[model samples]
Target chain A: MNERSLSTTTRATVPIHRRATLWDRLLEPVLGVNACFIYVFLYMPIVVLIAFSFSASPFSAVWGGFSIDWYIQLFQDSEIARALRNTLIVASFSMLFATIIGTMTALALSKFQFRGRNAFETTLNLPIVIPDIVQGISLLMFLVLVVHLALGLPTIIIAHTVFNISYVAVIVRARLHGFDRRLEEAAMDLGATEWQTFWKITFPLIWPGILSGALLAFTLSLDEFVVTFFVTGPGATTLPIQVYSMVKRGVTPEINALATLMLVASILLVTLSILLQRRRSS
Target chain B: MEKQRERGQLALLLLPSTLWLGLFFLAPLGIILVISLVQRGGPVAWQLDGSAYVRLLDPLHLKIFLRSLTLAVLTTFVCLLVGYPLAYYIAQRPPRLRHLLHFFVLLPLWANSLVLTYAWMVLLRPEGFFDSLLHALGFAEPISLLYTPTAVVIGLVYWYLPFMVYPLYGSIEKFDFTLIEAAHDLGATRFQAFRKVLLPLTMPGVMAGSLLVFISALGTFVVPALLGGDKTLMWGNLIQQRFLSTPQDWPLGAALSLAMMLFMSVGIWFYFRVNRESA
Candidate 1:
């Protein structure tokens, strides 16, 4: 889900053949139409949700008159605010810890050939393919049976950091792979120590990756629900938890407003990540 | 002295994550394996036992497991069917438009699955967007599509199409179209060229995308919890129910978690094996 990972892969990509074959000419329009329909299928639900957020009446199937009443209600709701605050608290801390730890891991993997490198790489990737249920339930069981930590914000932070570290490492590792290492070599050859070389040459070059990784880590921590749901204690409900509870009651226009707001925030963060990706490549 | 200094720097670079993942990630999973083997007697006491995993053979639990598999398979194939063409289209576009289209495909993912599933509920509910549209198109009745197995599949596909598209596009973009051209130049039929050349070359991506989409859709909680009614329980919801809800069957839940992990390990191992073989 990290845009940096997706867009970075496009940097050195080759474009397709331009000369149209007769077969292509016959097939292209059909495929293009199907693609357009697929895009609509993907996006139509979201557009409807946003439009309905402005509905004057709650839970009405008909087009209720447009109004900002739901927005006003959303802002005034303290529980929602508390949940948002909790989400931010967890996301910020998770981002900070995951970034520092993950960037170091990425540096180690990229800069040195180590024993058990492949094993460590696979270990780090467990989060990517492993189900959230495993991560969440295992963490919960660990906290309860062994660590005896409260199922509160701290536990949530731990769970998020565990997964976020891998994502951050992957992003930073991708960046490290794409970056030129000769600059660091040049710095070291000029009588700079390894430490100085890293600070002067390596860190600056990979800083964008680190920043984007941090952003992705933050965004992922925000977006997570399953693991957070399991580990979160009472009084520490995150926004997704709050949304789930509200949704269980019924889909109110208030949730529509909240989903819209969160999505807009996601768009802005994604735009920032893509911008950071551009900066990294340039 | 230089070698020692380099070693120290490497240690500094590696120790934090090594310890963090070791203690937090690996250790917790290890603990789950242990917990799954133990019997929960009192609130705080557990005895070494292996019966919990046996309970995983319960018909209800087995049904959920099968349902999870069925939904995941459907989601993966549907995503591949839809996403392959989209990825192909994006890959064939001019560079500027390709980026824009790629950005759009990733946009829904960025918006998060929870929100999108909610949107799906809104659209699929009785007299909702789909129903209204169908009515306007001359259908006389409202059909409730939400809270069904079909709705669950739709939700999974909606959220996970990006996972399929990303890997597929990666492969498709790297493919050499000239080989296909050569096939045509040599008088191979279009179908023949596509089957022999393009499909074989892009097979890795297809497999990669399917596995990515499958693994995710298999373990998804949100899509099932909201869109899949109580009748349509899945592995994720089962795990949640056992741990967080009335059951609180820690051992059984842990066993289920371990089972899910086992499934993922096989998928991931296969995934790496595929990539390694292709490379």
Candidate 2:
């Protein structure tokens, strides 16, 4: 009787174990499907954009046939070229200015302790949280009324630098957070002047952060729209503004081509930065 | 002598950025605040009138503010739902594979948001690729995905998911697996282990990510403008229209901008407070 009861209990528990295994089996594939679906959802639009960039249809919806005509036209269009050039000029200037200012601020904040430090840090990051539209309009109004700065490349550069500096400061600050101060002290003890020590020791140590921050700032300046939209005068139309106007008019095949190029360039830059960051961390 | 020189060097290093912020950011924002206090029309037009604050209290503007808040809240909730699982899965992966997964997470962020909006516009259009694909898959009707609030949500969620994911990933990666094992070993079920152990540990990351996504989504203009179409109206578009379009009401625009800034400042203040307490 006892053996019979034991067998019955084993039979009951074996099915429960089997059911648990089955549950695991079921969930594993479900999880895989979920991941795949999310990734596809994220990437499918980009894939379609690239695919239709080559489509012969003037409109994106009807894929008449495959052709690179839009791309060829993009090259031939002087306006697009001019916008691209202006964007590069603006981004380059913004990147340069933001990098220098950002690095300097990061160095100061990391090395020094003073009253109002928290307030300063928060204030620097304030631009990040402010809506771009508000920043743009306010800056536009201010440029027109208060500062009387020309609403052209200079204004755009200044506005870009304002936002870009925060990004640079944040990234460089992250790198600076765990930096070994002893190295700087060692250099100083070895009789290096502050400027020479910074150039030889601190600058080189923080070079990657500066580079990454500069790259990030460059990318931001390249892609910045709303602020540029408000600040840009008639003579200075960047690629994003051009794209916005194009989008407003209607979707066109040429825009798909231009967008694909922009997407590719940005991806390359970001990938390079990520790779560099990983290398440094490793 | 060296200490003085170091202080001088630090001052020199700090001067440029400080000046940039003082001139561009702080000064302009101050100007906006001053303008927000002024009347719409008068002989001394720019003089402080306090009427713009009253204008800000108008129901239409209030409605727009509420709509922005609703959208941002919804976006943050959805991002959390979607991002948490993916972050967990990535965190569970081996270190080598984790980096690859993170690269994909970062990929969307690298692409220009405008281009992403355009991509969605293409896919979500009436006869767009997505509609065609759905029809080919045996659906009788093409879904009306474009120019809807749903599209706005999708764009917002898509744009901000990375912001949510990265922070969660940061936290999850640092989570103590041993605690989970201990919970399980104490006869707790798998779900119980996750709830009692893992969730609490990752809460900080969740909070940070959600706040970042919420603040950004609240202010987003391009996504809504491009994807929301005629049906959906958010404050960003409203503010843009007032400033740039036919109305050209600088006072109203300035008032709206000030109100938005005030809202953001309050939100950020709360966010920092919570973060500080948690830390």
Candidate 3:
């Protein structure tokens, strides 16, 4: 009877064990392979470009030998230097405007109950959902018609700020969501004026949020292409526009070097932002 | 008195952003809508007409829209298939390593898109890296991969895959593995367990990622312009050529832009509806 029960129990569990093992054997390798293949696919082209940037030859596709001549050449290119200056100007000014406006918006949304709050929220999020092309076209048309704003640095900065404000607001508002309000209340209760309390208590706490938001806005505006493409006038070409034009005329080794440097800069900024955010949260 | 002061304070805080958005974003969109109904005379002139809207119903524009839609849908599908597994693997990683993996996934976005596309050009051009590798592997001939629809799709997927992966990772990171264990305990097979439990649980990520990828893919002009040679002009290129190229058909471009916006709203509505039901 014991033997019979053991055999029945074995029969009951055997198929399930077989199925589980079979599924794992089939799927585990497939999943691993898929994951590895995707990683390679994602990084290979980038790696190829970075490696070829140092080639002694002018042709990017064919590597000759190791040399930094392209890097030196990139520094001497007057047009690229001008684009870089334009890019920095737009990114910094736009970042400043976006941060101030966005922080205030975030503060208002978080601290108060108001009429049309939902409408305001939706308006802020609209740019995120709307296609970039639509945004670019509409903004271009508006600048050209209603404002008669000349396509130049100012227009580009304004366009960048328009979308970037929402990004900044969202990030700061996320910080405000978990904020401790009692400290501000305590400062108010202890005879601190509203403005003074804000300067002393609240601002210091959300300072990280504002800084990170500024960084994000800077990064976005620096690399913004589509809208800038629409609004940019002669002598106002940003790095991306310059890069686009260069790519159109067949990439030179100088561009490859420039691209590699830009990639490294972007990675460094993003990593710094991540570290700042992590430090704040921790 | 306190409430009044609070209201004033809030208004003071909100005014600048509101004014900026109103003057720039909302007003521009309104102007575009009006421009769509007007006839283009030249770069700076317009006549009140609706020829652009009428032209959209023509077979040619409709075909372009359908083609863009098809490409977007395909790109989204491929991204989902590739991104879901990658995100799942990343989410399964130890917590300390997950952040690094996520950063790696997003590294491409930090790099300029034009440069990224140029990299692909280097890899896929005639006698390029991909061709050379294949040739070295005993392949007799190089593949004509550049300036093709397949090349365009590959570039789009590479450009936007991180957007998909990030959202999926967000949703999947919060996934409850206990339910899978429960299914296993209930004698369901692994396939049945995943289909019944894991898939349903991660549907939100799938929808979110798909929506993000689809809209962006549909609106992209650069990928197609760079990778999709002259023959494979999508809707975005059509809109671009209208405004920037010969003829400068601003009205038609506005109409096309509005159509895309309308389509996006519909997609977003459907997404929210699905999201609410799932919630």
Candidate 4:
């Protein structure tokens, strides 16, 4: 390590021209322009969507006086209300289950060197890599055929949890990587039991991870379409499914308003999660 | 006794989740594989038949598979082309500002894909923003970009760009800029230095991001449905139609799923092989 360090230090000390060459000068502005273009590409649709949401025009393209009518209309729509309720219910329950299960899995994987550890790890991670369409169909078949379970809200929750578990576990496990085991060991060496030590010490340390993971799960389940679409029965329409059906019908300003609101909610939650993770690390 | 108790505790901790995954997650995949092999006459009637795999060989189904593959490949390529420069630009930013920049990159990713697709629909459909803009710019006809394969690819590339950016950012963030300077000191051209040093170091990210985009793009359902419409049918739409709509062929759906899964497995195997060789 010191040998490599010596070479690096010497290299650092060497006098090298720090002036921008022609290529650097040429490339910097080009990269800047490209970055600006990419940002526009990323954000223009969202800006336009939000802009059109407040447009009084029924058509997305037609501009008219700004109004809150579409948002008010969304509130009056009974289908929208039902879909919102269903989405919240699914998100909350799925978040809770996924967080608990994933936290437990993360703790076990990080703390133990047990038999089947590799197998268990791989099994947990499989859902992340498996295509959502495949997972959706597979669960649909199993629920309908093998298990003969009803296609309803519960099935949707379970389907969402399938992917959510892996996501939460991965996030929590990443947070656990830098955890110090000695604190738990020391607590145990004292009068504290393993359970006591875990609750008082480890739980607080990993709480940020758990919170962010839960938030992520909640958002994912809320936005989940394909899997929920597969497993859902009639009258169990979540917001995405509702939105999808409405899109199939035709274009509407109400959808623009609804999409804008959903976008805001997701961005807020994701920002909160990021802040939580950052605060924990700092 | 204490060691045994500890072992038991470990088992207890792992059991519930392991069982949940095994029963609900792994079991469903197994069921799909088994269903793929069996023949389904109706909802109730079933018999073992391998003809589903053979039926996938027909020209129409094969075209669907090829179309999905082509779209996914195109999406991955376009994402890489668009994302790499952005990743590099962000990676070159000051360390203090990197997280904020990364947050911006991840913002859209965390947004619902459905909502984003709807936004794209607003932009690309007939008389939509894109068409209107083109018409204002002296285009004679309404631009029919939406409900086409190109629209599907655009939507996919947009959806998956952040996935590519994050991994490439991870790789580029850790890259030592001094190495490129050293190559420059040794009289190498800027392009040569980037090609020799930066590219090699970041290959892992490129491959990982490409695979992530490719797999998702291949299996995406909603984008094609909303953007590609009925004509630009992909493997995912075909499978969805088979299961949920006309002909309600479960075995065929399963077979198509298995075929996709098999292709993914091979891709993953090849990924690991390359990774190992590189290591």
Candidate 5:
């Protein structure tokens, strides 16, 4: 564990590996260049997409003078508007239901004793671990063939909530681990009811966790495509579904605009989620 | 009486999650199982028919399965190789820089994967970004990578690279850098130190990251659909087409889906076993 005392690479560079051969000297710079290359590889495509979204050209990679023509076209398309609205509806509703159920489950698992702990954990993980395509097809079969139910907004919402619950539960469970159980017991001991203790102590403490979970669920539901595509009926097109068809049909600058907006929204929300998680841990 | 009340409250708290998962999650999986066992043609759907599972044994279907497995394996291997140095670089940074670098590594994961794949579509398509760039540089036209297996592999690699980096960073950060110094004190060369101590110490991370990337790549639907086109049909695409396209072969799709679930369960089980042994 004494080696653990040196946490950074500065020691290796300055004093520790000073016996470094020429090859050793070269290794650090090589690693630095490789890191730069990987970051470029990751961001280059998205940068191109965002750049061309503002270009006047429909599908050309060449800069045909920067313009917001595609953004205007995106706004004017009624189909895109409807799809955005549907996506919001699915995300909002799923986030709500998933948050409540997942928060309750988190409390139950962490604050109370339970049997079948392994079984419960495995069941929750099943929705997350299984491939989306498989889960999508399974739900499609259940709704269409088994129950003869129609596929539409409700089906999409149900599928999203199923997966979202597990995500929300996991995040809240982590937050719970850092919390003191005695706070709640103390509140109850001071003549408060169980419900009162929860409202005053537990809820406020875990509210950040719940908010993070809700944000995550909303973000995930917004981009969900495979399950929504499989289980969806005609007329309920979400943003991702719209983008899928538009891209498959042919090149339109409208898709570039749409993709850019979704990317911005996702990046912002995800950053916030990560920040919240960091705050919780710290 | 107090104990009974506490138990009642626990049950109440868990009820909503249990009820929802049972109805929407487990029941649907059970439905898939039921669908896989039944016949496609008959009005009497209750009779058990092994035809769909048998159909998977066909050489054509087997070919697709094998190709998908190979592509997924390739993607995992390539991501591991490409992502390791960056992971190591990030692990070596000081605290603040380390945090910032981690954000960069995780940003791709938290962002929209669909748009990311579409970004690749823009670059890889015929007469698209790369072709135009090449022309601008006075080169020949048509990289012609679109609608090919290589394009599929590239897209998969781009999408799952962060998954590879994440687990690698976790394990590598905890590794003692002094091990390398100690090996050097014992007169091991730099390469020898890396080979003997560093790689072996980080084997758990390598395996974890590989499992994550492999499982995700195998089941990916979007990359293959958008980039693979008609030529490179993966299990995900095959299942999608069977259910969504004409002829509506639900039974075959269900069987294929179950098979995929089996593959994934095995991968995860192996992953947990490895972690346990290391712990």
Candidate 6:
């Protein structure tokens, strides 16, 4: 073990010696420039959008003086408000439904050893790999024809639930995979009922995963467009669909402000969830 | 008695998700498959026919299919090329810096894709930010970057890079760096050590990342619609227009969607087969 450690330590030091080679010096500037270019490529557009959100120009490209009029106008637009309301409603229900179903699926799959279990697991993940458009169109056709369901919030919720289920299931399943099943067995041996064991033991242990999954589902539903676009009826337009239409017509400052706000909110929520997950794991 | 109840409870737990997916996902996909085979304009309008399949064989439809396939393949290739190095660099970093690097990578994913596309449009349009920057730099004419195939490819690459990076990062993080050191100690050069030890070890992550990006890019609608504009006609946009618009050509739309589904299913089937065999 000493010899192995010595040899490995010496070998690792080789890269340090080679770092000052001629080729390394030549490539150092090139690498720096490349990194700069990639950074600019990634961020310039976002900066532009944020900057132009305050532009007084109705058109995005032409920059007139800055004003918050579009932001004010956005507030007064009833359609936008209605769309926002619809989106929140759909997202809330979808997130709630997906979290419950996904948590159940995760618990069942992780705890059980039934035949065709792999097939079930694969099927659960299939919707995520399938193209959203295909899934959306297919769901639209099914609801209209086979199920005879109306095209509105219910349809959007169901469609969103399809994607959200897989996401939540995967995350919660991952958490369960690392879980100590012995804890549940111990709780049961201690005379706790199954419900009591789950609520007091399992649920508390996996609550972070459940919360993260819910947040993910919520974010996905909030930003969902293609599926929502297909299934939504006239008055069921969500924020993303509304933003898409506004862009297709032409770019405007209001969209930038809307997008920026969404960006901040999503980032904050996801960050919080990730931190919660880390804390739980640690 | 306790074990039996536990089994029963487990079954009950699975019932809800299974029933929901059976009713929603599996059933809907089945409906799409059936719809794909049917022809429009019959007395029983939505009745089964082979005309949709026939329409799928048309040159235009075939072209769209090929275009989508090519775009997906190219996007996967670019993402792998770009993401691998970044993942490697992040993996090589000190543990303290690794989390920060990963945060930067994941930042884009947290933001909405549609919003990202719009940001790209604002930056890349002829008279937009890029043009203004270039003109200020003394370029006479504005560069026409928007509504082009290149822009579409850029958008695809940008949006999907993090997806590729994370999986690769996961694999790289798990890799035993001592293997590379062992190779080096055995008189291998730096390049040889990396080529033989590091490369082969990270192959699974590379494959997973590439497969995920390629499959997702194949069906991408938002990027092409927003960035490529009307000039480029990806299958996603085509399917949407056909089904959702006034023409309401359900048969053609279903055919197109089914074709995309079939194409991706084959790709995924092949990917899993290869991955399983390799594993």
Question: Best DockQ goes to which candidate?
Answer: 5
Q: Score the docking of each candidate (DockQ).
A: 0.51, 0.43, 0.49, 0.55, 0.65, 0.50
Off by over 4 Å in 5: A1-19, A280-282, B42-44
lDDT of 5: 0.87
| lDDT tens readout by residue for model 3, B216-239 | 899898888888878778888888
Clashing pairs in 6: none
Judge the docking of candidate 1 as incorrect, acceptable, medium or high.
Answer: medium
Query: Docking quality tier of candidate 5?
Result: medium
Predictions in order: lDDT: 0.84, 0.83, 0.85, 0.86, 0.87, 0.82
Clashing pairs in 1: none
The numbered model that scores best in lDDT is 5
Angstrom error of the Cα, residue A192, model 1: value is: 5.2
> How would you class the docking of model 4?
medium
Q: How well is each residue in B2-82 modelled by candidate 1, as lDDT tens digits?
A: 777778888998888888888777888998888788886553246888888899999989999999999999999999988
Q: What TM-score, over all chains together, does every model reach?
A: 0.91, 0.91, 0.94, 0.94, 0.96, 0.91
Question: Candidate 6, B118: how far from true, in Å?
Answer: 0.9
**Deviation of model 2 at A209, angstroms:** 1.9
Top TM-score model: 5
**Per-residue accuracy of model 5 over B21-98 as CA lDDT, tens digit each:** 988889989988887888875322667887889887789889999989999999999999888888888888876788
lDDT of 4 by residue, A186-270 (tens): 9988889878998999999989998999999999998999888889998899999999999999988899999999999998988
Give the count of colliding residue pairs in each prediction.
0, 0, 0, 0, 0, 0
lDDT of 6 by residue, B103-193 (tens): 8887888788899898888788876777777776788887987998889899999999888988999998777777765675577776787
- Model 3, stretches more than 4 Å misplaced? A1-19, A58-62, B43-46, B136-140
Candidates 1 and 2: which is better by DockQ? 1
Residue-level lDDT tens digits of model 5 in A1-282: 433355644357333545768888888899999899888988888899999899887456678898998999899999999999999999999999999999999999997767897898889878888899988888877787667888899999999999999999999999899999998889988999999998998988888899999999999999888889888889999999999999889867888899999999999998888678767533
User: Could you arrange the candidates by lDDT from highest to lowest?
Assistant: 5, 4, 3, 1, 2, 6
Task: Report the Cα lDDT for residue A279, model 2.
Answer: 53
In candidate 2, residue B95 scores what lDDT?
64
